[model samples]
Target chain A: MAFSLLHGVHVPHRKNTRDMAAVRMDAPKTVVIPMSMHIGAPAKPVVKVGDTVKVGTLIAEAGGFVSAPIHASVSGKVTKITDYLLSNGTTVPAVVIESDGEMTPDETIAPPVVDSRDTLLEAIKRSGVVGLGGAGFPTHVKFSVDLGRIEYLVVNCAECEPYVTSDTRTMLDRVDDMKTALVAMKTHFGIRNIVVGIESNKKAAIKSMMGLMNEVVATGECTFTVKVLPSVYPQGGEKVLIYHTVGRVVPVGKLPIDVGCIAVNCTTLAAIGAYLKTGMPLVEKCVTVDGGCVKEPGNVIVPVGTAMSEVFEFCGGLTEAPDKVIYGGPMMGITVPDTSAPILKNTNAILALSKKETKLPKTTPCIRCGRCLNTCPFGLSPAAIARAYDKRDTVALDKLGVQACMECGCCSFVCPANRPLVQTNKLAKVLLKEEKAKEDAKA
Target chain B: MNTQLKLSVSPHIHSGRSTRRIMLDVLIALLPATAAGAVIFGLRSLLVVAVTVAACVGFEALFSLIAKKPIPVGDLSAAVTGLLLALNLPANIPLWQCVVGSLFAIVVVKGLFGGLGANPVNPAITARVFMLVAFATLTKAAFPTIVDTASSATPLAAEKATSLTDLLLGLHGGAIGETCAAALLLGGVYLLVRRVITWHVPVAFIGTVFLTSFIMEGMDATAALAAILSGGLLIGAIFMATDYVTSPATPWGKIIFGLGASLITFLIRYFGSYPEGVSFAILFMNILTPYISSWTRRRIFGMGGSKA
Candidate 1:
């Protein structure tokens, strides 16, 4: 009910790309499979050169507890296993497969013929499902909890960040898949309370899901609720959404799981639903490729690990070379080094921005207007901490709660004087954390 | 040929709002007051403002070039300084003195302090105070009333108090802008409507001046009114002293700022030697802005609210 201290920048939505057309699946000649797709250790290639592999077949198993398995999205001849550049500009081992036009999946773990609902845990683990939202944490790890505390299951349909409509389009086109996934989630977690929190900006998606949920509710298939959240940037953030929907705040440095709830992106759940019905693993993901620089900009269903070049090529090959290529939405996306880099499993959008869009002005000194403080959602002084870092004053930095900052770029967005507040705050947080660790060691 | 993409964080599309936009809006807001001055003072006021702006912009470019810093002439801070300097000056001041004031405002107060937003003090007020100390006679030059065409002094300069109407209409001669209370009020109102300034500073300033004078002078209505609407108070309290960078950030801080300026202005005009105290009051308050902001900062979120 209170005004959030931080007001995010109002950027152009660019959601018209999805409304203009349907999701077009890009059929590439050869899909480049990046071995390391999830957060932790890079995957080791399990197949060698000239090996024939089919869709849903695992090319590389999970390298560690934090890692997820890599699967082939298309039936193809394994051309070579070589070190290839990723979107982050780092080289990772990739499985290059030339599609044979058969589109045959090697083998699928058949849904429990008696009851697919019962195999939810094993299906999720074997499918190597990770959070498709952005963090890409292993989903199995979240459901593996026996603590019996998670009270609410929140489906994050709040693709509230501007220029991102992948989740919106997915929910629109795959409503059946969404409901099935929600039911599967409800069955697996053994929770009766379920809510889908979609931003109000997504009118069509809200309408579509609302109608479906209403029908299912009347039929007593399963209890489900669809709620429209106020359209605000970073409202999609797990903790912020938890507070807005459930009226609870996860403890500082903790997650939604700690607060008796779990929030999963709409795309992640839809993929789960498909995996349950058709018994397919997560091999390809829906990505929004729209910005000023691209000649044809729309959402395309892309195979995981497909070269970004092929994705651009399918969408009219870009009008001109982009000044910057980001892997997610404009607000929180990662800028990729080369188009040759493979799209990871968690990738949601590939924005190709022209030079005009990416041109940053030369930074001036901070005027101490306190706009940064007013807009920091975490309620820390970004400007003060940034100033302390600039002056190398660790004590000042520590006093201002510099370590609590999430580096959300909200401060930088609202600053009139354009001080590099976020960058400096990042340095301050790192230095102070290091200092605290040393003191702990000495004590 | 394989072209690699440069990877960076999100926010790929900028808002295109720049320092140039900020400085340009400030210049636009000062237009009404500048035009009013030109209309009241005739060609001389126009010449002073024009020459001051030209000199300030020229000096800024020249300084940046000599110092090998990137030229920020397009940012328009120099123009803002020049206009504020001209508004603070008397209409009869010579063109050479206008140039000197511009140099002091732009080169010394603004540029030497690291240019534009980095300047700790409001360059115009700092320059005006500096010039008043260096050239007292020229700073004190008075003009004839528009209606009577008779040589007159400001109500504040009177050994005996003048009428409230003369102070309000600014019929009595003073500085270029300080003579016209009506024009300054109109500009200040426009700025308020545009959200260029809040009502705290100007309202508190004028209110404290009137209230203090009433208390000290025992409800002598003419003296009380003159004390409120006198030299530089309207312009200084509204524009120069309320600058976002140099002023306090909180609402209460601005109130303190206005009250401080009013107290100082009254003490200097009635008790101290200076007939006008707007410049000194603003400068003094500007020095206290940081402390006032720190003291009056808002309680952060969740601090005053019920804990979860």
Candidate 2:
């Protein structure tokens, strides 16, 4: 029960499309792709309005050393270059294009000649493969680190978030691609231990991954194991997963690499394998569209810039008026103002929840039952942190380890008083950062 | 087309466990003790409990109206307070005294302090202390012996004379609810299973008392067992001392709170004039709860050997 100390609530696994194969959606009439999809600096657009571009064409180049390039998802003429609002309420510059009804591929869509490790890393960068687990971190940058120090390569198949089964679909349908990626990392990167951490609730996924690992092991390329974790919310979190699988602790403000582990999502690995085979950049995603308001719920493979409204329409539109359209799973998803937001590289699920699912409970005063403290995966006291944050007590917030909170919403979900513990933890982190910035400026 | 989509932070779902529901669970857990009290003390015990519950609810509602706050009597916290207060009172105590105790617990101790979760002390324990001080004779009055004889002494006062089985079965004289050891243990088990209360407080409190009593009685195990089975130790440990608002939340804090309570209780019972000391010990520890919580704050994960 070492992982038991990593406290989190058991969310309902509403994976309605777990057994359904993903159907490729027809290209929409228009697409609005945001320039800043990844975690680094926003990519700069190279094409202007009225420029004709084909699928896999580079529309936005990397803006910095850490940024990933963006490619066109459909053959189209650029209609407009404007600002678009994301589900998180932030505005980013976007390129809108009108499709010409032809699925034309770019001329640079040939498989790359990977002769060395550096070339493989370069190919990964050129493919614009970011972390498709919803973090959208540049994949090449993660692998660019010193490979000699890494001990384990962890494939995160723990699709622990509820109502999202896109990763599970990847494990079931794309096992060959997953195996190829894992074998490549082992043979090229010299990593010995390759572990695929999947929840036991996904028995099929565990079986598939285990079969792949056995086949790969028979070749004597590398040692592979499947670590079965008890299904819990946020089991896929980078730090939590590394801790559970490798028996390592990623310190605060540190990456998984610091703990001798490089963790990537299962879908990200499959996308990397596809890139290695075909050299096409990340331009489409498997989006799980299911909620109370959805008429026909299933997984749809849509282009990265497809509007949520178009996806919903393709799924037979709403059965009733929706009160919330979240861009991810219910536990950690951001609620969009409407259905017009375009899917990004990291958008895994678009849920149109009805009022029954999104209705907020009436909040009551804190009863000091310590349920939040018990449920926090990071072991931070959200109630105490919230109190310190409300009073603007930076010293107390720092002492209470407010910065350690992962914003997983476990505390808020378990709180009987409905105290908004996650929101307060987020704000408290922001406050701590501001205080640190102030101290740096003074110094 | 509907632009007015409801927006909030993450976690679009809740556990749906409301305060009212939790209070209801607690009331249900206390049923065994309530029934036992009624059977042992006769119908008069039920009247005391009913009157105290009504008075506590009424006072809370009246105070909210006067203070212009939203009435929170629906949460059933007032009912819990009333039941706890009635259980702490002597079976033969008058009903009007129960009303006064309910007023002190609800309006003065709980309502005036910003209501349910804001109170610094356990309302029932504080009110019981207030009543014991105000109506000393009534609180200390004789409990009708099981043999139909007039016995003015509680089992704790006649410690050596009372048999262990009589105390265990609650066949002797004491407060309305605290006398029924079997019923209290049953209720405690229910609360533990329901997870409404943790085991840290009750286990530490009773363990400390038993160990201290054993040492004080020259390592006499029977005397120690008799000491615990008699008096109000079970009721205070399971119900009153574990009150959510008044007790510490952290594991270490709860253990410290329980140890401090038992130490004070041992001193008062061994050296002081009172034969019973559970209520006063709990009240004293409640006053120090916040400090204990701050002192025993848990270490954040991955913060081992790091500077706070």
Candidate 3:
């Protein structure tokens, strides 16, 4: 029931672009915006082929309360509407647009009036903002927590993953927008405590926020503090951040709201503030473009749906042929299928790693070093979960709490034998789900 | 989709510490002990160590080839086993007998049980026990004929054990590596520094022996100190009992194992026929590692339980 703040692995903070402010890139020839960028339902396409659309125009509507709408990041004509393949290999309907190169904003774009909590959440839903830290969960759903249940609002800017600094840029560059969101939330939610969680390694971002901390709290009676956490990987995880900030464990199979907290990504909050002020929806993203193979690496403010290859090219392209192009940090990033896959709304960084960085050694037998379990942030025994998975013993897997694994890859990262521990944990969770499904059917 | 782009799982990076690197560290850590053994037991000790190492690696390679598996001699784990087994044996033992012991360790105990990291008990420790029982020369030479030695028998085997000073400096007759307490301690420090092993098992194992022996011998601290310095207690406690594959993985499990091993060792040393019980104690605890590990698992976050 208690949190071990000392848990989690110490990873290299390869913040190569920490000093580089994001540059806005020119619109490419075309863009392929996917409909299913958020966690829940895929947005239904409202535009057909040959339909003219402008920047900030809603091309797709939210499928459900949990889903987020899709907006045009660049003024263009609807070139095609077809199923597109995501990096995870899932096929979802996407809207393809041919950019006119003018980068024109939609004429109808205007800030919505948010006089109450419901309207604030409604404005957030209309903004199409998701967890821009790469989780892709709709931000409005998290914002719409029960008023009394949410006690602390945590701005998670930890950016604990290696080589990602978009959140750092948000803190350093978008102070006004972030403060606006904070003041808005304080007015509407009436939350007493506000904690800004960031790694200690990010001193610049820490200082940047520290200089302006009083601005948000000055409007109302609030306890706002910048909690500088240890620079450990997965410290930015919602559960870990919530625990480290509020010192409360969001119980197993529960949400942060259940623990009197709501942790949102700093960039996600910035986007909501920008949306409220300028009336433009979530269109552009500031992405950290760096890895071992990149020729020149920095942050780039690219429109959503721009092909990753174009983004990489704009960042000076690769020095060598990248053997693995991941869409996030090396610790928990998913490798893109190719350079052509369009960057999604939640994408914070694009890494092009050479063989030296991506090539894994031959996996030897488990030496039982306990490093996997020892370094696990949640204290889960990945080695035991691995055994239970091998035996298909669902009871053992459940008892080991396989579902608690957040797949931060800390276990796999520290494995001396190079075992795919987090990968096995993911599979074991799936197997446990299947077994439980069978039991439910029988019952 | 580009085939050149790897679609591997998450965690595209590694710590780069391999099993080979770990085994290499173990070999490096054993260097000081080997030198001390050679100095104390004479030139014959180095020969026995070299022959046993060669024999173990040879047997592992030969068995792997025969089993149609890739030869794993490059990992140097077999070399580590050979050195550990050599240290446990008498320095004056025949080189051919060393080969036999190495074969039992690398092929029979290790290879037959699914090779490295898969054996239920430590191959080197198990093979030492095996050779002790199977060969009468090992038992007969508990008291060596060498006149230059301080005593006819080892400090523990003799009725009048050597003084703490003699035992600490290893100025007595015993197994090649086990006699030199100073050397073994130096090697243990190296291993601890390199993080090849943790302080949990070594500290607990030696602490339990010291505490229990001090209590059992009417609070005689001198007698307890001699007990650890003599025989294979230092080498066994620091090296063999901390084997990652055979020992419990969790910290609490390791401590439990150390305590359990200490109990068995005291039972054997005080009442049983064997004058030294470190090897047997470690081997007994090795078999119980799986159970200890299951009982002392790190508590999962948000789960309702203690230990499990």
Candidate 4:
């Protein structure tokens, strides 16, 4: 029911590897498992140097309730335990394992015994599956919600950010796994309606998922439908996806579950299905390694903790000296200043852009054009927020809900004057928080 | 390699586009019009353009040097203003006058107001207006084509008439470049094709000029047509008035600006002291751009009401 504003920038998608043949990498000789992969506290290493570990073995234990545990992808002996750099540039404690290449299986937990009285919370905790699509929040913590009157179970299939197509390719390659995962999630959580939302940009993905859903229906399964959303950047965001697919807006400062709906990424569901079926712990993931600077730009199935250098070598190394290298898609992705940073869990894509292709305008003054206002899905005035921050006007910024900015880079993308709206807003937010803290201390 | 690069966050990608590229594009778009101006107005016009451009670039470079700011002359904003000042001038204007105009434009109007995108008014137009007021007789002297070395007044000098063909071709007495309607049209088309500008400003401005002048001429359609065709209306409407940073943001605001400019120019030509009003009309509308932008800004989400 909501109409989007005008003058959306038509940037080149550059999803070169999406249709290219998907390749699988041979197990690397060594993998550096970083202790901190997820958003929460860094996981503590349970293994020491020279300790032999098998595939699916828990090498790092969860440090806190918010953190998720790490598993070994290959049977290996821990060669060293030290701090190593991640793709995000921060150094964290990592378990360096030299793989035996045999991929020996580790000890497994007993299968779930279904009892009507058995709570869904305990099953999720036992499985050890976290959200596999970027934000690696523990799945059990999300599923352990109060369920007196829950309604919508939204599966986010909208890979809106350009160039990262792991989810689309996964849906096409493994629809059965996705469906099964959705059914399992539905049964485990006791949710009624489930909506699979895919951006209409991927016609093949939409068709494959539709066929799979029809197969479920022909076998007399209950209704679960897939809705095709209009292709818009950042449509994969939980709040935006919810609004686009199901005519509902997640309240300001509230989660999707707060509105009786819980959204999960498509790749996450597929991983859940794979984990449940094969009894394998979360390890390797499909990552898109393509850009203008990449000699052999393609998608490769890689294990977690693979060094970026090895992956680039596998893909055929640099075509030219790359000016910049990014870990994820361009819109919301971060820049890797160091090439040695290892790709951890939730690493989706590695993009290396040539200098000519990757040049960005030197930021100029804000002309107050309001193009940022038009393009923002949240309907926040980024230009005004930016203007207020220019003068350190905290009151005006708070009035504009500067905190609500998802830092999605949409505003920056559309700005003709080339102002770094999100980056400036980030600084303003930190300063505002610090100012509040100082006031609290004074009081 | 023992070189350890600085470690940063996830989005390691960039597109090589810099401020230099954008400014270069504008300079490229202005090339055709600059050539047309040079050819029509002779080496004297070329001399003025060269002097103004050199002055602008020199001033910008000198300021950055003295103040220890990065030399932003590479952005080509100073050059753009230089080219614009040349277009707004008569071929006979002295070289020192052009230099003064360039200094005022690049330094006082642009650098003083915050350079490039932050300038409130189009710097070139500001310089033209400033010169017009300061050196009225020198600035207003019209230089007709020298077939037998006779100084003639411009077609707009008298409230009589001019042929559309004369206006279309460069066969009239006026500013060095602005007299050629054909050249202005060609430049406008090139800019539109390059996606450097939108059609809102030019279309509205020219449209309003035509309609307003037509109404003001009353019974004399020839005079109406001549008024629209004469002066610097074509050049100002297509080029100077539609400056991306100075123009209105909204489609409706652009239309309002077009109407406001046309109405003011018509009133000035019909009833005011000045026989031509293109420069003043555009400068007046430039002041209203901010208000027009705010009024026409898309409503902020959820402040007024929740629409879901």
Candidate 5:
């Protein structure tokens, strides 16, 4: 029973459109592509205003080695080089492109030569691919990990958040692309082990992967296993996923590569596979649309820079006025200021929750029930973290492992007192980092 | 959609388990023991419980009104405190003493320290000890009018405290809720099944008491069994000592708290002049909760050594 601390909470998997095939939406009248989609230096705009661009045209170059490039999602004229406000209260330069009603592909597109590990990394960097699992980290940066020391390729298909099933479609409909990407990574890096991690609720997607596994075995690998974990919320969390699939505990402040594993999302790998074979960069995404205020719930394939208004209308626009419109699942989703905000590269699902659906209970005094300590998959004590943060005790914050908190929101969701626990954990991490910066300056 | 979009934080959905709902579950779990107490001591005990509950709720409302805070009577914690204090009292005690005990439990022990989770001691258990010293007719256990039995200080130390069946069945002399081992065990199972309480504290406390008594009785299993089943050990370990606010939240802390409590309980009952030591032992542990919790703090995951 002591092992229960490492367990996560059970979240309701509200997969309303898991069985529906995705419908490809037509190009909208306009698109707004932002430069700072991933967590690195913002990409620099390469195309000027009034420049004519086609789909897959390079509009922005990588600002640094840690950044990714951006491509035009539709054939259009660059109307304005203005700024777009993000949810973090800061604005970044955005390219407003008005479509020409004809989604034309660039004529100069051609697949890159991929004979070795160096070519694979360069091709991935040019493909404009990032983590599609909502992190938006540059995919090429992850592939450049310790090459020979890597033991397993853990593909995360665990779409554990409720009302989000974009990865399920990737597993069901894009297996060929996934298999090609897996085989390419395995043969180039000589990594024998590959594990596709999925939850038990998606039976159809598991069966499809099983069929694809038989075909991928001939290409190369040591063991190809489908680890079906329990349908727990945050099962796909990077550390939790690595621990569940490879049976290794990534130490505090350490990456998965330190433990001989390279974790990548299933959709990110499939996008890379498509780019490697067809020479087309990432321009479109399959978004899951469903929530309490939605009249019609399904998946739609739309261009990457489309606005939430156009995407919602494509899914038979929201039924009623939404009190909250988030950019992903309800657990860790970013709430946009309004529906007029354009989608980013890592936008997986857009939810418009009604007022009743998002209503939280009145907060009461803490009863010291210990549920928050028990609910965290990492066994971190959110209650104690909140106490230390209130006092601004940086020394105590570091001792409690506040940086290990993944902001999964499990403790906040299960608190009977309705304490804003995870939010406090996030603030505590920032405070500790500031303290370290000040100490370094003094030294 | 609309311009009136609310931009709150993550985790918009909740588990729907409020403090009131948890308190409601606890109140429901205490039903079987209340019924057995009524059957053993007659309807007069029920009247005492009702008066005590009403007084507790009234006093809580009064205190909150005076303090100009949002009244927490809606959380039902006051009702729980009253019911617990009443059951620990003698069934035939005067109704005015019931009111006095309710005041001590709510306004003095609980509300004065700040309501709900702020008290350093278990309010009901502490109030019971206060009454035991302040009142004269506190130890004489009440029996049904039909049974011609002699009342004693407690079933633990009486000359006529024979017949294990009478002790288990609540036909002996004891507190209103403590006599019937069978009824209290049923209620304990209910709380465990509903997950209102964990098993660490109750199991450790009861197991320690049983083991110590077994060794003291020269390895006689029957005497040890009778030792635990008598007195108020079951009610104290399961219901009174397991209060969330005063008890330790970590697993190891809870076990240590329980073991320390059993050690003191056995010392007093074995050597001291009192026949019952459960309430006093719990009060002592409650005072040491902060130190115990800090000493037994759980290690975070991925922090160097063993698995958390």
Candidate 6:
């Protein structure tokens, strides 16, 4: 079937570990699991300091319906419950566990009994599954939406971020588990159509997914389709993937389910599959650890809460002191303040970049080239929006649709003048929010 | 562990294409034409280009210093303006007049109006127009002698017996760079390939001129072809009319700007007194850029239907 091409920038796909199998690392000496890995409310710590816990132990429970629970990633005693600094510069409560050197499984760890939709969602929530595609939205909350409205279940295998191939590794290493999860979704959730959107760059992953689809077809399951998307940056974006595969636009401020679709990350599905089989919650993650500064770079399966410094050491420590270490893909990744931050549930890649790679380009005046306009996936006039923002014109900002910017960094990346368009877009959004709050208070 | 890590926004990487780099590309693309102009009009043509460029850069730096703005001479935008302004002038025109034109362009037309991207008109075209008005007798009477043949009038003014080959090869009497159609085309192609400029404005502008001249002259193909090849049409369309700051940013806006410039050019060439109308037409259209840009704002992706 012909799928419409979605708009996105053609970024360099530095999938250095596309062919490298992920090697599992033993738990670090200490694990610092943050209480707020997922969006919405932060999880509240239930385990106290010095309390003994094992892998898959519930260390923190969901603080709200939109939040996901946190699990003990190491067999250890809780060292401390302390405030941890996130990459975004906010402090969150984190439980630090000192490894006991004997990896033990929790006594309650066993295969989940899934007979109905409620049981499946409960099992998913219990497993602490979230969107492993970087946004970290709670997975059970996504599935809890009206299942009848979701017509297409899009498996986002299009790991289009540069220097990140963890999803590709998951698709190659966990094909059977992915198929099992898909079949479960088909039979239980009543999702009729399943679309696996993989970028053409990942030929091995696409081939493996297609093989799974054939096996599923033999069983006479729901219609399974593998949509090959162009290798464009942000092709894995929820809205872009939906538009390309299902030919539907999730209008501004609407969820994917609003367009009769539910998009799940490829690794997220693999996690769900693994949980259904082994009852192991999100304890470890397959992270692609490769960047310019590293001596040896490849994908490694790291336990959650492992310090980034430990991950870098496992990858043969930096050749030179890195100027920046980014979490997730280079395009939309957040630069961590330091390597002391622990890997979260959604952390896909930890890039240790050299000075040359991280040095900010000198900004010049905008030449009014309109390349930013042409490159923005959401069709925002970044140049005009920057002007409106600088002038503090709230009405112009509203009319220009500054709030619709996805902050994918395409505009800033492509600007020849090196104008900080994405930075200005972010500021514009904040300004608009502040103005709106003031108006609301007045009203 | 002691190394400090930089913390900024999301995009930690850039394409590294700077304003200086973009200006350098424009300069590189203009090399063939500048070389051709020098070769065709003798070593004096090179002196004209050099003086104008130096004068323009000096004026820009002086004005920037006086105005307390950052000296942006390194970006090579002033050099581009100087080269363009020099190319539009007669080879035998006085060097002092060239300096005056450069000063007018950089100081009044550009620097006074917030500099560079904030200017409302193309600096080179506005400067050319200024010189044409201020030094009318000198500019009109200073046409270069073509290969020792003393032809007083340019090919456009002569209007009767000039060969198309001479026009294409730029062997006839004209301004320094405007005479070489082949060289200008090569440079234009380079700019297009480098993505420094798009083909929309140049194609539409040249196409409109070709079509309008053909219709105006009652299907005279030679007249229409000569009209395009002669005067400053090629240089203006390829270089000045497509100035990133002065021209519209949207594709539709560029097309409209091109068409409007071509129509005015045709009107001035056929009905008005000037033999060459490229400078005035482009300057007039540059003034309407904001309006054209607003009217032709691209229909944003996934925003209602594909309509303005």
- Predicted structure with the largest DockQ when compared to the true one: 5
Worst 10 residues of 1 chain B by lDDT: B299-308
Clashes (N, CA, C under 3 Å) per candidate: 3, 0, 0, 16, 1, 0
Candidate 5 structure quality by residue, lDDT tens digits, A196-297: 889999999999989877888876546798988889988989888877887777888887888888899999999999998999999898889889888888
Better of 2 and 4 by TM-score: 2
Per-residue lDDT over B1-308 for candidate 2, one digit per residue giving the tens place of the 0 to 100 score: 55788887899987777777788888887888888888777878888889999999999999999999998888889999999888888777888889999999998899889998989999999998898889975456446444554533576776476777777777678788888789999999988998899999999999999999999999999999988887889999999999989999888889999999999999989998888899999999999999998887766766764212
Candidate 1 wrongly placed segments (more than 4 Å): A1-5, A85-91, A112-119, A212-227, A437-443, B4-7, B65-68, B138-141, B149-153, B156-172, B178-230, B250-276, B296-308
- lDDT tens digits by residue: candidate 3, A338-419: 8888878999999998888765667888888888888888889898788788998999988899999899999888887787
For candidate 4, lDDT tens digit of each residue in A3-51?
A: 5422233445666676865588878888988888777778889998889
Q: Is candidate 5 or candidate 6 better by lDDT?
A: 6
Q: What lDDT is reached at residue A403 by model 2?
A: 84
In terms of DockQ, which candidate is stronger, 4 or 5? 5
CA lDDT of B130 in candidate 4?
92
lDDT of 1 by residue, A265-334 (tens): 8888888788878877898888888877777888888878688888888788888778888888776778
Model 6 whole-model lDDT (C-alpha atoms): 0.87
- The C-alpha stretches of model 5 lying farther than 4 A from their native spots are A1-5, B151-153, B160-162, B306-308
Residue B266's lDDT within candidate 5 is 94
lDDT by residue (tens digit), candidate 1, B1-308: 14766666555555555666656766776776676666666668878888988999999999999889988777677887888888888888878877887888888877888876667788889888888888865556556435554545666675444466666666666666666677788878877775556798999999999898988889886677777777888888887877877888667888999999999998998799888898999998888887987787654323334332
Runs in model 2 with CA error above 4 Å? A1-4, A219-221, B1-3, B141-147, B151-153, B159-169, B215-223, B304-308
Q: i-RMS values of the candidates, in order?
A: 3.3, 2.8, 2.9, 4.1, 1.8, 2.7
TM-score of chain B of 4: 0.88
Against the true chain A, what TM-score does chain A of candidate 6 give? 0.98
Candidate 6 to truth, TM = 0.97
- TM-score for each prediction? 0.88, 0.95, 0.96, 0.86, 0.96, 0.97
The TM-score of candidate 1 is: 0.88
Q: Model 4 misses residue B208 by how many Å?
A: 3.6
Which lDDT tens digits does candidate 2 get at residues A195-304? Answer: 88899899898999989889889768577889999998889988888888887888888788887889999999998888888888889999899999999999999998
Clashes of 5: 1
